[model samples]
Target chain A: MSTAAATHDDHHDHHHAPTGLKRWLFSTNHKDIGTLYLWFSFAMFLAGGFMAMVIRAELLEPGMQFVDPEFFNQMTTVHGLIMVFGAVMPATVGLANWMIPLMIGAPDMALPRMNNWSFWILPFAFAILIGSVIMSAFGDGNPSAPNFGWTFYAPLSTKYGPDSTDLFILSVHMMGISSIMGAINVVVTVFNMRAPGMTLMKMPLFVWTWLITAFLLIAVIPVLAGAVTMMLTDRHFGTSFFDAAGGGDPVLFQHVFWFFGHPEVYIMILPSFGIVSAIIPAFARKPLFGYASMVYATASIALLSFVVWAHHMFTVGMPLAGTLFFMYMTMLISVPTGVKVFNWVATMWRGSMSFELPMKWAIAFVVLFTCGGLSGLMLAITPVDFQYHDTYFVVAHFHYVLVTGAIFSIFAAAYYWLPKWSGVMPNKTLGELHFWNSLISANLLFFPMHFVGLAGMPRRYADYALQFADYNFWISIGGFWFGLSQLLFLAVAVLCAMKKGEKAAAKPWDGAEGLEWEVPSPAPFHTYDTPPVVK
Target chain B: MSEKQLSVEERNKRTLKKLLIWAVAMFGFAFLMVPFYNVICDITGLNGKTSSTAATDVPEQVVADRTVTVEFITQKGDGISGEFTSETKRVKVHPGEITLVHFYASNPTSTDMITQSIPSVTPGEAARYLHKTQCFCFDQQTLAAGERKDMPMIFYLDPEIPRHINQFTLSYTIFDVTERVAGKNNSVAVN
Candidate 1:
């Protein structure tokens, strides 16, 4: 260990600050790894967004103009894969890598070498996935991609999957491995490497949330590994895990997958909760209300996640007792989630709140996330789920939680910390403009999906009935606007990175407090060569 | 310094002890998850128990005498295909013999075709079979153009089936396999 540390020190100073392409390829710094994650996530976001637009365009009119049914299925599947794995997860990990050490006053990630390995594995995983999609173009059968949806239900996954399903399986395995490693590093770092005075309770909410999220990741990723492994064996090794012909149950796959998947949804959003908690207080000029309750609430939500897996399979013919159990369990999640929302609002209530870009995004998150939460509650009822299952309603519910709830919080965190990272405050006018457009357009995009879903339109279909055509058209319009609005975000970020914006103070936000704020603006290439004591 | 103040070395030592304890605790916690999962599975009866084995064991002779039904549906909503034959041969049964029936599907399409979909076949019941498998119907098949394929399905009829009826009819439907589209031309052709 000492030799490894010595080698790290020797190379750390002289590493040319890693210039151009090679920096991203062979970098070992936590910040560089974070940057890689962020950039890759953004690229995947665009790719996934593009697929969504195609889906919307096809659904724009009753008839499919742009794509065929099989292709539409592929779009939905890949879009989901990219967004969940490629966009949201990577973005959250990036934020963790960048913020966790700084917030805890650590020099760097506890396992920097492992961090590099985790990031490096992602490109390869995505390459295989993207390559599989490309391979389908030459195949003779459907000329479409894996349309079984991202859940890749058995029978469909096993019997109907593309020839490249093997590749997809391998890709998912690699990504899962990367996530587990990244999560382990986070757990070790937060628990082992905190500076003096930074007790678990005293640690920043972001660190706490990440610690919890890491635990959830470690617990659930292996289940995903198990589920996909079943898929692989069923497909190749003729296993009966999901094969009814051989006495296997297809719905069991749903049980195992969602067991991993439900927590995964929390894993994506929980850190956002931490980010919003941190930002809301700083802007509101108040100490966060019910801080300990907020922690307990987060724990409650994570604990409840395991019991709610069957909620996703409600329509798949679950027994009445099982359905009722899942419904109550899912509803219980809302109590903690509601506590979080109420705390955010209470923290902001009647304080000297200022609407900076980060604050704007945070405020929007509170309102929008609540709306998402309400829809989640609606879906929690077994009877209501019967009406909403597999409909645009489910789509609307998750997009609200994920896009506005999780992704928006990420935007807020990026803006909140941008000055510290780049030495320049992002252009305020453009930032605010981007915020309002995104907030409004995002709502416009996902809010109506509830109605479309309720009106009895199934999700993941290429074409819909004439009744759904109007709503889908409007949704498409909103989606396009939302996609365009992201360009503004990119512009602002690039401008700030190039130092074309206002210079910022080390502590740009007045109410900001933390070891991170005590450091110089734009933080040095290497920060806290000696760890700082936290109070 | 106050009497309560600790020396820097002492503080460092305390921190190290705390960290070591945390590491050990975490490792112990992680180590317990597997056993904990197994316990939960055992309680829930989800410990990968083969559904058939969990139920009363049907005699192999009875399983052999039973006739299984297979139905196929189309993806384009075209319903069943032309006079689809059950892939399994008929079983001979004595009076009052309960036996498992097996069936399968063959796709004869110029293009690679997946059976639209099939419903599950289980044991017992007259019109429908009780499903002991954890999943629904057969795996989707991707047959190449002009390829002949056979997909096998297994099931059993209760002894009561003979009292209620003498013969069973099995049906199947075929559908043109579809492709998955991502963005514009970004598509994955299903095999």
Candidate 2:
């Protein structure tokens, strides 16, 4: 895009947005790639959600009816892998793609070609991952897809693993490469391309959170790449990285995997911290109560993440000193996390607040995420973890944070920004219906798992004891209803994109602030052809 | 464009190049962790790979006031056919006193085999304190078909074995490395 072309096309739709499939296939625009990332993630969510339904259905009556034990394992494993890599992380990146340049007043991302490459690579990565699952189910040879849980712990992943593990390893490498590229784009755009006067501290919270999340992605994704690579060699080559018979230790695998795994959990959620930080303040009509503290808190959480990974392995018989060190360090994370939670409520305290669809999701996030955090704190205590480990309680704790916390924040962001992208208001009734339907049913689904988990209903089991049948049945019903509620979200998005509602003005929310609000609704094909001064 | 604008372009280009290079370097760093883990194990002895050498000083052995129970455990690798058993299951010894243990191994299969026994000390911190003067683990054992042998471990637990534990398990898993050795030099290139 040249200066002359940019000038000609900045406000003229006729001169840009190349028609048909070429618009997506050959596009260099950040907005287009962002849109692609969002739709792709939504599709992955539906696919993964279907797998969750199969799992819940099989568990409903304590005897496996819908799927056999093997397929059940596949369902849980692929569902987690797809949701984390394909759904949650990509959606966050999608939002960053659309909003960061606008929030920072940059003309576009620093490297547009690489942005397109990152977005396009996701389809092939997911294809191989999902396709391997299909191949595993039907292939004449040993199954290929990863069934060793999303954690893919060794022995199951290595020495005794199936033929398809090699493909899983390759898919993970592709995903890692895509993530690292996406992170590089975000970091470079934030640092080098911010418009004049948009100081690091002055940029919007979403931008700040993405900035830190990008750093985290760069740091951990490569470590994961290393981990899977070792797994690959151990399985295919004679190298005994995780083979005990070969003088290699299996627990060594856990130490390396969780090193990446811990930061990875944060990589999923920290952006939600940024998202709620943006939505709560806007709806509250107040400057964030502790913006500085929130930034530092996020940084502290990121730094502490590297040290607390061993908390996940308490049941693996870690040395006592290692156990105590990780336990206390993991608890220390609560302090910074508490700061973030308090700042959100403080921003809303006594303020003239209005609840929009986005605000509703954000509010739900604050309460639900705190509940998740408390359970996480419980898990961090070394002695108690022996009981909770691999139980439904652990499952409930993560889904509460991951589903209700991270995914809900993504829902809020989509609602908040859908009008800007499509130049029309999301149908309010459908939005609210989606929120309440999801909220009530998701609680019903996840909350009972805690009780049964404490009662010793081990997670990853295809069947439960007869004593646990009632809770499992209720939980399954909740899962189906929660899965159905998402169709409302899909409808709201498609209709808004089709321009079914009232046309939006440049600014939709009355209390909104930031460079994003300064742009026209249905942000033009090109914006900030020359950077807008942030001041 | 002015000189300042040119410099901004130069700076952005340099930083972008640096980041791309860093991404490649990070990928390399992932492969590095394989060797890196072994380095840490060498330094900290975290994996509990006990060294079977006696201390030069040979200080007078004084039995501690408390005892740390040592349990002998054994397992045969799936790919190997052998009857591996420990002569004794458990021994109670005061810390700082020497103890001797024996293990029996017989090649029940028709083929000759080279067997390597990998040892681990549980309550892992105990690994550092359990010292060996002579143990079969120092060398791999080669047994012909129908051959049997007795192996010995001479060792003492250091007084430093922490107070919280009264018992620890030392287990050895045996792997038949005949084919693996012929396949390659098969020794774990660990430090």
Candidate 3:
């Protein structure tokens, strides 16, 4: 594996990987850690989905039927927290770990040991969080998990909160640390580790999006840490950072939290934007439409995210000036987001389009995510938000974005790259079944939520009024169907891992063009030991 | 090959150092928000976290003959039922003239209780203009069981307060912070 004085072909041998449990415990390999993060995220997804099941089951008949009201509150809180931090974020990082270096022609991440540390810290961090949730539920009078919502509003979270709030705060702190460390590694790698010919513009859209997303992470994650730290001190250390009774304004907490939070929404979706950009062009059998504009659009969206934090607080009675400013700035996000969507559509206009599984998911991503985006634009109107705030409309909007947009892209990425990574092609019928089931049921699950919300059904409630009954029942059915449909994807992934399908070629997708595709199927344990010459 | 490995190691160390520094600095900057808010508010007046000083910034005091009425409203806390009343329901004072008011607090609880009052002015327009040089809200009031205490607040409405705000209500919510500052002596640690 030595590289000095070689003609850049030193990666001819298969390196023997360490066997058994120790391999995962200490392995710094990008592929291994990527797989671990993906699996861990899938498990979290299931956990969050199970919580959703409880929520939907409770909502089925308009009154409390299954769980107690306090437990219902816990389910909502943990569902949002786990899905955001555990499922979506970790899965994105997993893809980045496996694909970023491969796309950029680097042998590995710039900081491999730190990468392992980043991955390892997450399971324990989430353990503390979920443990607190369980303790609150069953600790024989111990306070249940922090139930003031994932935002953990002041006073409700600080003054009246259970002792488990401390655990939630500390767990969030660890999650923030992991995110920052992962971000820094991505930044340094993208900046200093690219192959000689792969200039910033020439790099894949995935790399470009990750570069921006990583910078956003570094800038905002610390603020989130600071916020939770202040919450910790306010709860225990006699600090009145958010205490209204002690001269501190509770509104101040909202200001600081959203400052980090608004950017975080982009941190999750920007990479999906990148993946969509990649998939649309590849399956269209054409060069990307307006690649440079796509890059600029991503950058502008990131920049605009900072100023629009107040849109989330429109219902908090912000000053008219602040409301208008945030309203317009939030509306401004639609422009760049529009350009990205238009670019994807334009890329597929009059080209050799294929409806393969990955493309199917990508196409669904564009349409359904646009549905989410348009609803988001509706939410951006400050006056309109007054009616929609704290309602299922907001819930519907984000699920459309996160589930149909981000999670769909994750599945698309898996299908697009599964052949290359496993050296085995998945069953197409199963893949399509997975896609259609997820797509249709996800809409049924989320779309009716908009109606119930508009009809004044409040969110996070264990029971609903009689008028909201029919939609809730249908939404629950959709929820069950969507939950069951995920098994198809799981089975397909398992079969691919077991080499139960056809042997994949070196370049499985003919239109795929990248340094990754240049490598043989089931990319060797040590790829490009001598970095490939990317032209 | 070993030399190449050494160079990679050195580069990673450099990046790690830079990143660690940035994380620390951001953390520091977050805590700095306490002071930063004050400094920025001083310039922009965006937040009304008014601080009282010995004297007003204006050299000329334009005391007006026109009177403005101020009403006092009190909110009592749980386990802190008390007879909290002002010396009078209303005070009419000329702008920029010092006005003195008295508040009476009685602790009906069997155990000694510590209480804090949070103040806000209605119509909110003259909240910042109504500055109290000495208010019971500036310190926690501890009363023994069945003990009644008289408290005084001395303040002046700034002459520059817009005349449209002719009347304002000064309301305070008395919170039983008996548990918060229970162990601390000298509870008047003003921020």
Q: What TM-score does each of the candidates earn? A: 0.78, 0.95, 0.91
The alpha-carbon lDDT assigned to residue B188 of candidate 1 equals 19
Residues A209-267 of candidate 1: C-alpha lDDT, one tens digit per residue: 98899888877887787777778876766455665434445766777788888999999
Output the better candidate (1/3) by TM-score: 3
Order the candidates by lDDT, highest first.
Answer: 2, 3, 1
Candidate 2 chain A: worst-modelled 10 consecutive residues by lDDT: A1-10
Task: Name the candidate, 1 or 2, with the larger TM-score value.
Answer: 2
Model 3 sits at an interface RMSD, in angstroms, of: 3.5
- Chain B TM-score, model 1, reads 0.37
Classify candidate 3 by CAPRI docking class. acceptable
Best by the TM-score measure = 2
Task: Score each candidate by Cα lDDT.
Answer: 0.74, 0.86, 0.84
* Share of reference contacts found in each model: 0.00, 0.34, 0.30
lDDT of 1 by residue, B13-86 (tens): 45445544543453344334434543443344332221232224453445445443433222222322323444
Q: Return the candidate ranking by DockQ, descending.
A: 2, 3, 1
What does the TM-score come to for chain B in model 3? 0.70
DockQ of 1: 0.06
Window of ten residues with lowest summed lDDT in model 1 chain A: A1-10
* Clash count, predicted structure 1: 32
True contacts kept of 1: 0.00
True-vs-predicted CA distance for residue A197, candidate 3, Å: 0.3
